[model samples]
Target: MFKEMKLLKPSWITALLVIVLSLLSIQNYRVLPAKEDIIFAAIHWHGPVLLTQTLLLCLIAWQVVSFRKIRFLVAIRGKDEVIQKNLLKLMTMEVIGYFILFDGSYLLTGHPIFSKGPVIIGILMLVLRMVLVWFLGLLLITTYTAPYPGLILLGVLVVNLFYHYVIEMNFLLIQYSQTYDPLWKAFNLNR
Candidate 1:
């Protein structure tokens, strides 16, 4: 199974980029309130983020299993016709997974963990975030790869930067005020 699997350099580069950027974003979030409250906020924010990270890992596992199964079947059948179809499916899954994992990391950077919600609600939030991130990734990738689409990619990147820095920050501020601020305050004051 390991012998049959190959990782592309570009995909690895993209993954690294996503991870570094996500970490930077999370660090920015830590400073949103104050240096003294960083630990309090991190404790409050880690639970749901950890859950979502687990789900994302599960998705990657499923993709790997599916790829291995398809490869095994191809080996047993020894058919050329099916190989192309299966390989295409595998590649598509890999690309989709790459984009989802990257974008989901970005989403996790700003999202606060819910302390009192039902487990189902937390799961739903994770799913919704993943879906939204996947959609955004798809749109950006599509535009970037379209014929003579550099201009479109640039436009999309500008908008994405605006949304991330301006719109999402404001949204997070509003959300944290309603949901996370009291918990953070209590946690810090008690400590």
Candidate 2:
């Protein structure tokens, strides 16, 4: 079963696409509302949240996919510790990035987390990412495998589509302004 599962590898392009979309969406959100308003309203909108969540999930998927490529136990000697350490590092980075980008700052963004729908969704995504990572690790360890790439890809597509619909419904599309938005300008701390 494990060997069968290892056949699947996530598409690097898709992962990169998710990250790019999420970052662009977040940039859009951060620029829309008045600069003086609370940052939460700007950052925690539906579209931005969905994009961030998708990006994090894609990162997690990539981590597991990479792990799946290596043989669980190599016949060659003395490579086990190095491989294990590297895997641990990758998992740690994914978990940390997921939390920081999706959860940690999110809680601080809105007025008292629960007061806003977007914040709630952000929290949910954060928890979901954590749970997903745990399950991915478990699958890697116990099954020495994961679901087929096709299944994972299908899931990603479904989630992406649902996210797109939600963003559209919320009218949270990323619209680039003709001029650089003040938020971006300020971030650059120029003019």
Candidate 3:
């Protein structure tokens, strides 16, 4: 019913991409948004709350979804732990770079993304977008590497449907941002 997989053995190119992107974070966003601004800054994509939730979910989903849906135990069944750890390191680096670039860009340039229509509905819609895009990424990556990736990709979608973490995290982000948005920034920080 199941076979061992070493799906996350990241290639040198992937590592290079992670390294390059992390280097970019060293630019623009040097530190947290000064002091009190950190609170208001929490709503933006770079905010700690949102990023933490997303990271935790991604980690959890990687194992939980794979185990339940794909029927394979990653990091446990074999020599997968080392590969998983390396992939995690690179992923973490990339995420940090993402935060720096987006937040710093906002601070230096202006708001990069926003809700197009209303507030709550638009936020949920954005959540849907994230969920779909993430699923697509999972599909594409799995398809490229593993010959029997359809079931794994389907597992990702099933997991998303069941846990709905994408919506939950985005909702929390919006609420936190709304709660902490400074008068000067207003809705600008709710990216």
The better candidate by TM-score, 1 or 2, is 2
Please, what are the lDDT tens digits per residue for candidate 2 over residues 68-114?
Answer: 54544442444545544555554455445544554444444443443
Q: List the residue pairs that clash in candidate 1.
A: none
Strongest candidate by lDDT: 2
Clashes of 1: 0
- lDDT of every predicted structure (CA atoms): 0.42, 0.45, 0.42
Task: Arrange candidates, best TM-score first.
Answer: 2, 1, 3
Clashing residue pairs, candidate 2? Answer: 40-109
After superposing candidate 2, which stretches have Cα over 4 Å from the reference?
Answer: 1-25, 31-44, 48-50, 67-89, 102-147, 156-191
Candidate 3 residue lDDT tens string, 1-191: 23323334445654455444433433334553443232233334343333333443344335333533442443255644444454454444444444454345545634323322235654454445444434434443443236565576566555644443444344544453454224525666555
Top candidate, metric TM-score: 2
TM-score result, candidate 3: 0.31
Q: Which ranges of candidate 3 are over 4 A from the true structure?
A: 1-78, 110-191
TM-score of decoy 2: 0.41
The 10-residue segment with the lowest total lDDT in model 3: 36-45
**Which digits, one per residue and each the tens of the lDDT, describe model 1 over residues 1-191?**
43343431225643564454445435545344432232223234452234333343333333334444445455666643443344344434544554455445534555444444444544554454445444433443333124544454455445544544454334543353434455566778787
The TM-scores of all predictions, comma-separated, are 0.35, 0.41, 0.31
